[model samples]
Target: MFIQNALPQKPNLWKYIIGLIVVVFFWRGLGSIPLIAAMFTKASDLGSIDMTPAGLADLLGANLFLSVMLSSFVLGLIGLFLYVKFVHKQSIRSLTTSREKIDWGRIFFSFFVTILFIGGFLYAGVMMEPDSYQWNFNKEAFIILAAIVLLMLPLQTSFEEYFFRGYLLQGLGVATNSRFWSLVITSSLFGLMHIFNPEIQKIGYAVLTVYIGLGFLMGIMTLMDEGLELALGFHAANNMTIALMVTTDWSALQTDALYVSSAEPDLGGMLLFLGGMFVVLLGIFALRYRWKNWGNKLFGKALVLEEETTA
Candidate 1:
């Protein structure tokens, strides 16, 4: 089974929530038409919006961050809120699986480990090229920009995480009475959603094999760990570092970063990314969460053929 199917069944509400999400996606993509027609479809301009090729292309024609946020990001959030409040009939605490309430330990552990990982890379980069990275420390301007980005960007990233790995994972698991299919469908959709990223254009579609692999990795973490806390922390750290530490002309999430790497992103970096994610997964597994049915949890069928199955 992919999900435990332990939650109280609520089919009618679930349908409404799903409808709202579809509506949000429709408007978001459709609404981008005007922006796309305005810009010549430049990647850099869209990077400022949310780092996706579609959004960046829109920026190429019309580089207005506010419109993108107002039309797409905010609409999505409002839809999510409606889903949670009206459709799911769930509180934030309930949606997060508050068996013991919020798990601060898991969140902090993942957060601290990510800080160390990113710090190690930064240290290595500095040692390798001291003169390559000049500090961009306009404190006043940066502080304001940082505040704006921090406030806005997390909504975009967190919405993806909660929707794909948390809300969808849990809902589908419950709906199907299986955990396995939840992971498969959720992770597959997550990766497919990124197909239009500018990085795919610059680095080839093969890079997304690793990306799909990552979706599986994070999905496994959510299912095995039975929560999104760790995945959330890791994702937040990964993106926050990219937003604050490095900015590339071809990269998503272009910002006033601390350093700009001259080296092109390569296959080696993709391998390293996969390697690092597995390492973290291994560490979590080593913590002995007592996770069970490893194969079924990740790759098996989600349907519960037997009533006695616990999922």
Candidate 2:
């Protein structure tokens, strides 16, 4: 039913291709200008800029740089909503869920659920390896970071969910008429999108499994839940918690978080831990939602209902 929402629009492959191009133009092309300009100005003042996360944080100051970085997604989201409305003749509600209204309840539930897990795990990690973490909290910096995280980071994560799970998922499912392939392609692209993350350089290519695994987990959640609310909440919480709770040199975004990790990431153990957590979350969601019809919902063909076309 979620993917079928696209059916009434008579989804053409070209529309999706062109739509993506437009969104990316706003997101990456025009959106990057401010950040680039800021970096250039900073470099000119400083005589050289490092360009690494830490370097940029130092150059532009963490909160300002983070704001500029996330501003891109804001523009991209605007571009996407415009295209979906005018070009595709689809409502934002339809892009979000089959439900009559966007479910804020589900979003908050998922958000708090993820926050609990992240907080719990972080506490455990700090206790188990006291030497790995240092108190890095600065009251003024943290207050600023909190404001940015609360306001701007959601836009970034929302953009990703709307693009990957909402737009591309529906588009691909309609194009291939196969839910399975749609999940696979979108999840893979989501993973590939993170290939250049600083974590890869720090933790090695094996870390990609974690990213890909996250993509699959989010994709499965989207398909099973038939909405982006859960995925959106989960994604936002995951990033927000990380941004608020911790920072490390090799991290993609280095901020004045509460703690800084000095320990080298254990890729193998992290993979297993995260993989297990994914399963547990899935089980919880499955039980709570009472998800049924796995065969049809996940792997079955996506058909355009005649009623949808007529309506």
Candidate 3:
């Protein structure tokens, strides 16, 4: 039903291809100008600057750097909306869910549940390995960071969801005529998008399993639930929690979080632990949402009804 929302318009594959280019130009090209200008100014002052997340965060100050970095996504989201509305002739609500309206209830439920889970895990980790974390709370900096996270971070995460889970997922599903291929391609692309993150360098390419795994989890959620609400909420909460609770040298974004971790991440152990947690979460979601028709929803053919095409 969600994928079929694209049926009435019959948007060709080329539209998606060109849409991606437009979104990327807005996100990476136009959006990066401010960051580039800031870096250039900093380079002139320091005679040189390191071209890394940490370096940029340090040079521009963490909050300012983060705001500028996330601004790109805000622009990208705008571009996506324009394309979806005009080029695709699809309503934003249709892109988001198959429901008559956007389900704020589901989004909030997933958001709060994920936040609680992440908070509890962080608390337990801190308790178990006290030496691995250092208190890094700064009253002023944290307030600023919180404001930015509350406002800008959602836009960034939303942009990703709209692109990956919403736009691209639907496009691929209709194009390939199979939910399975759509899931696989989008999930893998989502994972590969993070290949250059600082954490990958610290933890090795094996970390891609975690990224790809999470993508699959979200894709599965989208397919089973027939909406992007849960995935969007989960993603926002996951990043927001990490941004607020913990920071590490090798993190993708170095934030003024409440705690800084010095622990060397154990890749294998982390994989096992996260894998177990993902399974449990999936089970819980399935139960809560009363998900059924697993075989059809996940692997079924994406069919466009004749009536829908005529309408």
Candidate 4:
């Protein structure tokens, strides 16, 4: 049904291809402006600075780097809306959900569930190892970080959902005519997008398995829920809450958060943690959503008239 939203219009396959390129170009080109400006503001000798996560954070200051980094994603989000509206000639609602109204409940529920599950333990760890966390809180600076996060993370995560889960997933599904391949392609691409992130570089490429795997789970969630609500909310809550709650030397965006992890990456431990959490998360989501017929939903044909199929 979600994929069928692209069908009524019978969009040319090239439209999806060209649109993706245009959007990404604008996203990268515009997003790079801040980083470029930082070369001037953050450097006396730009050539000497390493471009890694900690390196950038050190040069730009944690708060300013995060603010600038997230600022680029804002333009990327706008690019998606513009391309979807004019190029695809699709309404934002159509891009978002099949319901007459977008389901805020699903979004909020996913948000709460994911935060409680992930953040709860992260906070517990900070408490348990009081030495691992140094309170980096500053009243004036934290107020600024909170404001930047509130404004930017939603835009960043929402754009990711709209692009990966909503746009590419549906477009590829229609083109390939198989839900499995669509999921595979989009999920892999989602992982690849983060190929340049500091986490992957820090933890080694094995971490991509986690990224790709999470992409698959999120894609499955999108298909199962018949919308982007759960996926969008979960992503937003994960990034926003994490940025507010902690800063780690290895994280993508190092911010002035309340706690910072001093632990080095233990690949086995990291993988185990991700794999374990993923299983529990899927189990919980499955029960909450009452998901059924995995064989049909994931591997079956794309529905023709979503209403007939869903009904």
How many Å off is the CA of 229 in candidate 4?
0.4
lDDT of each: 0.63, 0.89, 0.90, 0.83
**1 or 4, greater by TM-score:** 4
RMSD of 3: 2.4
Tens digits of per-residue lDDT, candidate 2, 89-192, equal: 99999999878899999899889989898878988888999899999889999999999999999999999999999999999988899988999999889988
Total colliding residue pairs, candidate 1: 14
- Expressed as tens digits, the lDDT of each residue in 103-205 for candidate 3 is 9888988899888888898989999999999999999999999999999999999999999999999999989999999999999999999998988878889
- Which stretches in model 4 have alpha-carbon errors above 4 Å? 305-311
lDDT of 1 at 173: 71
> How does residue 52 of candidate 1 score in lDDT?
59
Per-residue lDDT of candidate 1, residues 78-169 (tens digit):
56656666666666555554345767677667766775777678668767886666666566646654665566655666666767876678
Name the candidate, 1 or 3, with the larger lDDT value: 3
Residue 39 displacement in candidate 2 (angstroms): 1.8
TM-score of each: 0.76, 0.95, 0.95, 0.92
